[model samples]
Target: MFTLKTATSFEETIKKSLFICHATPITSAEEALAFFQTYHQADATHNCWAFKLTQSYRFNDDGEPGGTAGRPILQAIEGQELVNVAVLVIRYFGGIKLGTGGLVRAYGGTAAKCLHQAEKEKIIPTTLIRCTATFSEMAMVKSRLWQEGVQLISEDFTENGVCWILSIPDEQLDVLSAVYTNITRGRIFEKIET
Candidate 1:
Protein backbone atom coordinates (compact mmCIF):
# COMPACT_ATOMS: atom_id res chain seq x y z
CA MET A 1 0.00 0.00 0.00
CA PHE A 2 2.89 2.30 -0.81
CA THR A 3 3.77 4.08 -4.02
CA LEU A 4 5.36 7.17 -5.46
CA LYS A 5 3.04 10.04 -6.29
CA THR A 6 4.87 11.27 -9.39
CA ALA A 7 7.59 10.54 -11.88
CA THR A 8 10.86 12.40 -11.45
CA SER A 9 13.59 13.20 -13.93
CA PHE A 10 17.02 14.55 -13.17
CA GLU A 11 20.04 15.58 -15.18
CA GLU A 12 23.70 15.59 -14.28
CA THR A 13 27.04 15.89 -15.99
CA ILE A 14 29.38 12.95 -15.63
CA LYS A 15 32.70 13.09 -17.43
CA LYS A 16 31.38 15.83 -19.77
CA SER A 17 28.34 14.02 -21.28
CA LEU A 18 24.93 14.87 -19.89
CA PHE A 19 23.13 12.09 -18.03
CA ILE A 20 19.37 12.24 -17.91
CA CYS A 21 17.53 9.78 -15.72
CA HIS A 22 13.76 9.46 -15.72
CA ALA A 23 12.26 7.50 -12.84
CA THR A 24 8.60 6.54 -12.73
CA PRO A 25 6.51 4.20 -10.65
CA ILE A 26 4.88 1.52 -12.79
CA THR A 27 2.52 -1.35 -11.97
CA SER A 28 3.87 -3.92 -14.41
CA ALA A 29 7.02 -5.03 -16.16
CA GLU A 30 5.54 -4.36 -19.60
CA GLU A 31 4.79 -0.78 -18.62
CA ALA A 32 8.36 -0.31 -17.41
CA LEU A 33 9.90 -1.53 -20.64
CA ALA A 34 7.47 0.51 -22.70
CA PHE A 35 8.52 3.65 -20.87
CA PHE A 36 12.17 3.03 -21.69
CA GLN A 37 11.39 2.46 -25.35
CA THR A 38 9.19 5.55 -25.54
CA TYR A 39 11.63 7.99 -24.00
CA HIS A 40 14.91 6.65 -25.34
CA GLN A 41 16.62 8.79 -27.95
CA ALA A 42 17.78 6.44 -30.70
CA ASP A 43 20.69 8.63 -31.74
CA ALA A 44 22.19 8.80 -28.27
CA THR A 45 25.42 6.96 -27.66
CA HIS A 46 23.91 4.90 -24.84
CA ASN A 47 20.41 4.45 -23.46
CA CYS A 48 20.89 2.26 -20.41
CA TRP A 49 17.85 1.31 -18.32
CA ALA A 50 16.70 -0.65 -15.26
CA PHE A 51 13.34 -1.65 -13.81
CA LYS A 52 11.90 -3.63 -10.90
CA LEU A 53 8.39 -4.92 -10.16
CA THR A 54 7.76 -6.82 -6.98
CA GLN A 55 10.50 -9.47 -7.00
CA SER A 56 11.21 -9.58 -10.73
CA TYR A 57 12.95 -7.23 -13.16
CA ARG A 58 15.73 -6.74 -15.73
CA PHE A 59 18.33 -4.21 -16.72
CA ASN A 60 20.34 -3.71 -19.87
CA ASP A 61 23.53 -1.78 -20.44
CA ASP A 62 22.51 -1.22 -24.10
CA GLY A 63 26.10 -1.97 -25.17
CA GLU A 64 27.88 -0.01 -22.46
CA PRO A 65 29.64 -3.04 -21.01
CA GLY A 66 28.95 -6.46 -19.41
CA GLY A 67 27.90 -5.16 -15.95
CA THR A 68 29.13 -1.62 -15.92
CA ALA A 69 25.82 0.10 -16.45
CA GLY A 70 22.54 -1.81 -16.10
CA ARG A 71 23.15 -4.12 -13.17
CA PRO A 72 24.35 -1.40 -10.83
CA ILE A 73 21.43 0.83 -11.66
CA LEU A 74 19.02 -2.02 -10.99
CA GLN A 75 20.73 -2.59 -7.66
CA ALA A 76 20.24 1.03 -6.77
CA ILE A 77 16.51 0.75 -7.52
CA GLU A 78 16.15 -2.30 -5.32
CA GLY A 79 18.26 -0.77 -2.62
CA GLN A 80 15.83 2.10 -2.45
CA GLU A 81 13.01 -0.40 -1.73
CA LEU A 82 11.18 0.81 -4.79
CA VAL A 83 8.53 -1.35 -6.45
CA ASN A 84 6.80 -1.18 -9.79
CA VAL A 85 9.35 1.33 -10.95
CA ALA A 86 11.62 1.95 -13.92
CA VAL A 87 14.72 4.05 -14.41
CA LEU A 88 15.87 5.04 -17.86
CA VAL A 89 19.27 6.74 -18.01
CA ILE A 90 20.18 8.24 -21.34
CA ARG A 91 23.78 9.12 -21.94
CA TYR A 92 24.92 11.48 -24.69
CA PHE A 93 28.66 11.25 -24.95
CA GLY A 94 30.50 14.58 -24.86
CA GLY A 95 33.41 13.08 -26.82
CA ILE A 96 34.88 12.18 -23.43
CA LYS A 97 35.36 8.79 -21.86
CA LEU A 98 34.46 7.37 -18.44
CA GLY A 99 35.55 3.81 -17.93
CA THR A 100 32.89 1.06 -17.81
CA GLY A 101 32.88 0.99 -14.01
CA GLY A 102 32.53 4.74 -13.87
CA LEU A 103 29.47 4.57 -16.13
CA VAL A 104 27.80 2.01 -13.86
CA ARG A 105 28.27 4.11 -10.78
CA ALA A 106 27.13 7.22 -12.59
CA TYR A 107 23.89 5.74 -13.96
CA GLY A 108 22.92 4.00 -10.73
CA GLY A 109 23.97 6.86 -8.51
CA THR A 110 22.04 9.40 -10.53
CA ALA A 111 18.90 7.26 -10.54
CA ALA A 112 19.07 6.68 -6.80
CA LYS A 113 19.31 10.38 -6.20
CA CYS A 114 16.31 11.05 -8.42
CA LEU A 115 14.18 8.59 -6.55
CA HIS A 116 15.34 9.97 -3.27
CA GLN A 117 14.01 13.34 -4.30
CA ALA A 118 10.57 12.00 -5.27
CA GLU A 119 7.71 11.87 -2.79
CA LYS A 120 6.11 8.67 -1.56
CA GLU A 121 2.49 8.06 -0.52
CA LYS A 122 0.51 5.38 1.23
CA ILE A 123 -2.68 3.85 -0.21
CA ILE A 124 -5.08 2.28 2.27
CA PRO A 125 -7.41 -0.35 0.79
CA THR A 126 -11.09 -0.48 1.71
CA THR A 127 -13.56 -3.34 1.26
CA LEU A 128 -17.36 -3.40 1.19
CA ILE A 129 -19.18 -5.69 3.63
CA ARG A 130 -22.72 -6.42 4.73
CA CYS A 131 -23.41 -6.40 8.48
CA THR A 132 -26.61 -7.25 10.30
CA ALA A 133 -27.48 -6.57 13.93
CA THR A 134 -30.48 -6.25 16.26
CA PHE A 135 -31.99 -2.85 17.06
CA SER A 136 -30.86 -2.93 20.68
CA GLU A 137 -27.23 -3.42 19.64
CA MET A 138 -27.12 -0.62 17.08
CA ALA A 139 -25.76 2.11 19.34
CA MET A 140 -22.73 0.16 20.60
CA VAL A 141 -21.89 -1.20 17.15
CA LYS A 142 -22.08 2.25 15.63
CA SER A 143 -19.85 3.78 18.30
CA ARG A 144 -17.16 1.11 18.10
CA LEU A 145 -17.10 1.06 14.32
CA TRP A 146 -16.79 4.82 14.14
CA GLN A 147 -13.87 4.67 16.57
CA GLU A 148 -12.21 2.09 14.37
CA GLY A 149 -12.66 4.27 11.26
CA VAL A 150 -15.27 2.01 9.67
CA GLN A 151 -17.67 3.98 7.53
CA LEU A 152 -21.39 3.21 7.67
CA ILE A 153 -22.02 3.51 3.94
CA SER A 154 -25.73 2.64 4.00
CA GLU A 155 -28.43 0.77 5.95
CA ASP A 156 -31.69 -1.07 5.40
CA PHE A 157 -34.27 -1.17 8.20
CA THR A 158 -36.18 -4.44 8.56
CA GLU A 159 -38.24 -6.52 11.01
CA ASN A 160 -34.98 -7.81 12.53
CA GLY A 161 -33.73 -4.23 12.81
CA VAL A 162 -31.05 -3.05 10.39
CA CYS A 163 -28.84 -4.57 7.70
CA TRP A 164 -25.93 -2.17 7.20
CA ILE A 165 -23.35 -1.76 4.50
CA LEU A 166 -19.90 -0.75 5.68
CA SER A 167 -16.32 -0.27 4.50
CA ILE A 168 -13.49 -1.64 6.60
CA PRO A 169 -9.78 -2.27 6.38
CA ASP A 170 -8.85 -5.88 5.78
CA GLU A 171 -6.55 -6.07 8.78
CA GLN A 172 -9.32 -5.00 11.17
CA LEU A 173 -11.76 -7.81 10.32
CA ASP A 174 -11.04 -9.97 13.35
CA VAL A 175 -11.29 -7.14 15.86
CA LEU A 176 -14.41 -5.87 14.11
CA SER A 177 -15.98 -9.32 14.26
CA ALA A 178 -15.38 -9.43 18.00
CA VAL A 179 -17.00 -6.07 18.44
CA TYR A 180 -20.04 -7.28 16.54
CA THR A 181 -20.35 -10.32 18.81
CA ASN A 182 -20.23 -8.23 22.01
CA ILE A 183 -22.80 -5.81 20.63
CA THR A 184 -25.40 -8.24 19.27
CA ARG A 185 -24.78 -11.26 21.52
CA GLY A 186 -23.78 -13.31 18.43
CA ARG A 187 -26.93 -12.29 16.54
CA ILE A 188 -24.90 -10.15 14.16
CA PHE A 189 -23.66 -11.62 10.88
CA GLU A 190 -21.05 -10.22 8.53
CA LYS A 191 -20.53 -11.43 5.00
CA ILE A 192 -16.97 -12.33 4.06
CA GLU A 193 -15.45 -10.67 1.07
CA THR A 194 -14.74 -12.99 -1.86
Candidate 2:
Protein backbone atom coordinates (compact mmCIF):
# COMPACT_ATOMS: atom_id res chain seq x y z
CA MET A 1 0.00 0.00 0.00
CA PHE A 2 0.95 3.63 -0.53
CA THR A 3 0.21 6.86 1.33
CA LEU A 4 0.62 10.54 0.75
CA LYS A 5 3.88 12.00 1.97
CA THR A 6 2.31 15.35 2.73
CA ALA A 7 -0.83 17.42 2.38
CA THR A 8 -1.55 18.70 -1.14
CA SER A 9 -4.14 20.66 -3.01
CA PHE A 10 -5.38 21.60 -6.48
CA GLU A 11 -7.98 23.98 -7.83
CA GLU A 12 -9.74 24.38 -11.15
CA THR A 13 -12.75 25.92 -12.79
CA ILE A 14 -15.27 23.79 -14.63
CA LYS A 15 -18.21 25.37 -16.40
CA LYS A 16 -17.45 28.53 -14.44
CA SER A 17 -17.81 26.63 -11.12
CA LEU A 18 -14.79 26.48 -8.84
CA PHE A 19 -13.56 23.14 -7.55
CA ILE A 20 -10.85 22.80 -4.93
CA CYS A 21 -9.37 19.52 -3.83
CA HIS A 22 -7.32 18.96 -0.71
CA ALA A 23 -5.67 15.63 -0.03
CA THR A 24 -4.15 14.64 3.30
CA PRO A 25 -2.65 11.55 4.85
CA ILE A 26 -4.88 10.04 7.53
CA THR A 27 -4.58 6.89 9.58
CA SER A 28 -8.06 6.69 11.12
CA ALA A 29 -11.63 7.88 10.83
CA GLU A 30 -10.99 10.44 13.55
CA GLU A 31 -8.19 11.94 11.53
CA ALA A 32 -10.43 11.96 8.46
CA LEU A 33 -13.10 13.83 10.37
CA ALA A 34 -10.48 16.24 11.69
CA PHE A 35 -9.28 16.88 8.17
CA PHE A 36 -12.81 17.66 7.08
CA GLN A 37 -13.25 20.01 9.99
CA THR A 38 -9.97 21.75 9.18
CA TYR A 39 -10.51 22.20 5.46
CA HIS A 40 -14.21 22.33 4.81
CA GLN A 41 -15.24 25.68 3.37
CA ALA A 42 -18.32 27.01 5.03
CA ASP A 43 -19.14 29.43 2.21
CA ALA A 44 -18.82 26.84 -0.54
CA THR A 45 -21.73 25.19 -2.19
CA HIS A 46 -20.63 21.67 -1.35
CA ASN A 47 -17.98 19.94 0.76
CA CYS A 48 -17.70 16.53 -0.79
CA TRP A 49 -15.15 14.10 0.67
CA ALA A 50 -13.76 10.57 0.59
CA PHE A 51 -11.40 8.52 2.71
CA LYS A 52 -9.70 5.12 2.44
CA LEU A 53 -8.22 3.29 5.41
CA THR A 54 -7.04 -0.26 5.76
CA GLN A 55 -10.21 -1.33 7.57
CA SER A 56 -12.76 1.27 6.56
CA TYR A 57 -13.76 3.68 3.80
CA ARG A 58 -16.41 6.32 3.34
CA PHE A 59 -17.58 9.09 1.01
CA ASN A 60 -20.08 11.92 1.09
CA ASP A 61 -21.64 13.75 -1.84
CA ASP A 62 -22.59 16.86 0.22
CA GLY A 63 -25.70 17.67 -1.82
CA GLU A 64 -24.23 16.82 -5.19
CA PRO A 65 -25.94 14.09 -7.19
CA GLY A 66 -26.03 10.78 -5.30
CA GLY A 67 -22.90 9.40 -6.94
CA THR A 68 -21.39 12.37 -8.64
CA ALA A 69 -18.77 13.85 -6.33
CA GLY A 70 -17.64 11.71 -3.40
CA ARG A 71 -17.64 8.31 -5.09
CA PRO A 72 -15.54 9.67 -7.94
CA ILE A 73 -13.04 11.03 -5.44
CA LEU A 74 -12.86 7.66 -3.74
CA GLN A 75 -12.36 6.00 -7.12
CA ALA A 76 -9.50 8.36 -7.81
CA ILE A 77 -7.81 7.35 -4.55
CA GLU A 78 -8.29 3.69 -5.44
CA GLY A 79 -6.95 4.28 -8.93
CA GLN A 80 -3.75 5.51 -7.33
CA GLU A 81 -3.57 2.47 -5.03
CA LEU A 82 -3.65 4.73 -2.01
CA VAL A 83 -4.65 3.81 1.53
CA ASN A 84 -4.80 5.87 4.71
CA VAL A 85 -5.82 9.00 2.92
CA ALA A 86 -8.62 11.53 2.96
CA VAL A 87 -9.63 13.94 0.22
CA LEU A 88 -12.03 16.85 0.39
CA VAL A 89 -13.42 18.62 -2.64
CA ILE A 90 -15.10 21.96 -2.10
CA ARG A 91 -17.24 23.57 -4.74
CA TYR A 92 -18.42 27.13 -5.18
CA PHE A 93 -21.23 27.44 -7.66
CA GLY A 94 -20.59 30.21 -10.15
CA GLY A 95 -24.13 30.48 -11.45
CA ILE A 96 -23.28 27.78 -14.00
CA LYS A 97 -24.99 24.42 -13.76
CA LEU A 98 -22.73 21.44 -14.44
CA GLY A 99 -24.49 18.18 -15.04
CA THR A 100 -23.67 15.10 -13.02
CA GLY A 101 -20.98 13.97 -15.45
CA GLY A 102 -19.34 17.36 -15.34
CA LEU A 103 -19.35 17.37 -11.55
CA VAL A 104 -17.75 13.94 -11.44
CA ARG A 105 -15.04 14.96 -13.84
CA ALA A 106 -14.37 18.14 -11.96
CA TYR A 107 -14.15 16.60 -8.47
CA GLY A 108 -12.44 13.35 -9.41
CA GLY A 109 -10.05 14.86 -11.88
CA THR A 110 -9.05 17.57 -9.48
CA ALA A 111 -8.45 15.08 -6.66
CA ALA A 112 -6.49 12.74 -8.92
CA LYS A 113 -4.38 15.57 -10.20
CA CYS A 114 -3.61 16.78 -6.71
CA LEU A 115 -2.68 13.33 -5.55
CA HIS A 116 -0.52 12.71 -8.58
CA GLN A 117 1.33 15.93 -7.95
CA ALA A 118 1.99 15.07 -4.31
CA GLU A 119 4.80 12.86 -3.07
CA LYS A 120 3.98 9.28 -2.09
CA GLU A 121 5.76 6.74 0.06
CA LYS A 122 5.34 3.03 0.56
CA ILE A 123 3.79 1.90 3.85
CA ILE A 124 6.21 -0.37 5.63
CA PRO A 125 4.64 -2.53 8.30
CA THR A 126 6.47 -2.26 11.60
CA THR A 127 6.69 -4.15 14.85
CA LEU A 128 7.62 -2.76 18.22
CA ILE A 129 10.41 -4.44 20.16
CA ARG A 130 11.46 -3.82 23.73
CA CYS A 131 15.06 -4.45 24.69
CA THR A 132 16.76 -4.28 28.03
CA ALA A 133 20.53 -3.97 28.07
CA THR A 134 23.20 -3.19 30.63
CA PHE A 135 24.63 0.32 30.52
CA SER A 136 27.90 -1.12 29.30
CA GLU A 137 26.11 -2.64 26.29
CA MET A 138 24.25 0.51 25.39
CA ALA A 139 26.74 1.86 22.85
CA MET A 140 26.93 -1.36 20.90
CA VAL A 141 23.18 -1.84 20.89
CA LYS A 142 22.61 1.70 19.72
CA SER A 143 25.14 1.27 16.95
CA ARG A 144 23.58 -1.98 15.81
CA LEU A 145 20.14 -0.43 15.82
CA TRP A 146 21.36 2.46 13.69
CA GLN A 147 23.01 0.09 11.26
CA GLU A 148 19.81 -1.90 10.94
CA GLY A 149 17.69 1.24 10.33
CA VAL A 150 15.59 0.57 13.41
CA GLN A 151 13.76 3.50 14.87
CA LEU A 152 14.27 4.08 18.58
CA ILE A 153 10.98 5.13 20.11
CA SER A 154 11.96 5.61 23.75
CA GLU A 155 14.75 4.87 26.20
CA ASP A 156 14.38 4.46 29.94
CA PHE A 157 17.13 3.92 32.45
CA THR A 158 16.42 1.27 35.03
CA GLU A 159 18.25 0.12 38.16
CA ASN A 160 19.78 -2.80 36.28
CA GLY A 161 19.91 -1.56 32.70
CA VAL A 162 18.32 0.62 30.11
CA CYS A 163 15.05 -0.29 28.49
CA TRP A 164 14.62 0.71 24.89
CA ILE A 165 11.46 0.69 22.80
CA LEU A 166 12.16 0.29 19.10
CA SER A 167 10.20 0.08 15.92
CA ILE A 168 11.63 -2.43 13.48
CA PRO A 169 10.46 -3.49 10.06
CA ASP A 170 8.14 -6.41 10.72
CA GLU A 171 10.01 -8.68 8.32
CA GLN A 172 13.34 -8.13 10.07
CA LEU A 173 12.44 -9.06 13.62
CA ASP A 174 14.10 -12.48 13.60
CA VAL A 175 17.27 -11.28 11.98
CA LEU A 176 17.52 -8.35 14.35
CA SER A 177 16.97 -10.57 17.36
CA ALA A 178 19.83 -12.83 16.31
CA VAL A 179 22.06 -9.86 15.70
CA TYR A 180 21.24 -8.39 19.07
CA THR A 181 22.02 -11.69 20.76
CA ASN A 182 25.33 -11.85 19.03
CA ILE A 183 26.20 -8.26 19.91
CA THR A 184 25.49 -8.68 23.60
CA ARG A 185 26.69 -12.26 23.83
CA GLY A 186 23.17 -13.21 24.98
CA ARG A 187 23.33 -10.68 27.80
CA ILE A 188 20.66 -8.33 26.47
CA PHE A 189 17.08 -9.53 26.44
CA GLU A 190 14.63 -8.64 23.67
CA LYS A 191 10.96 -9.24 23.16
CA ILE A 192 8.41 -8.16 20.60
CA GLU A 193 5.67 -5.92 21.92
CA THR A 194 2.24 -7.38 21.40
**Top of the candidates by lDDT:** 2
Give lDDT tens digits, candidate 2, residues 1-194. Answer: 89999999999888888889999999899999999999989999999999999888999999999999999999999999999999999999999888988888888998999999989999888878788788888888887765465788898999977888898887877777887889878844455756
The 10 consecutive residues of candidate 2 with the worst lDDT sum are 185-194
Give Cα-based local distance difference scores for all models. 0.81, 0.89
Residue-level lDDT tens digits of model 1 in 1-194: 34568898999998899988898889888899889989999998889998887668899999997898889888887787777788998889998788877887888898888888888766455667788767887777777776565777889999977788888876886788788777777754466464
Each model's TM-score, in the order given? 0.70, 0.83
Q: Could you tell me how far off, in angstroms, the CA of residue 175 lies in candidate 2 after the best superposition?
A: 1.3
Candidate no. 1 TM-score: 0.70
What's the lDDT for candidate 2?
0.89
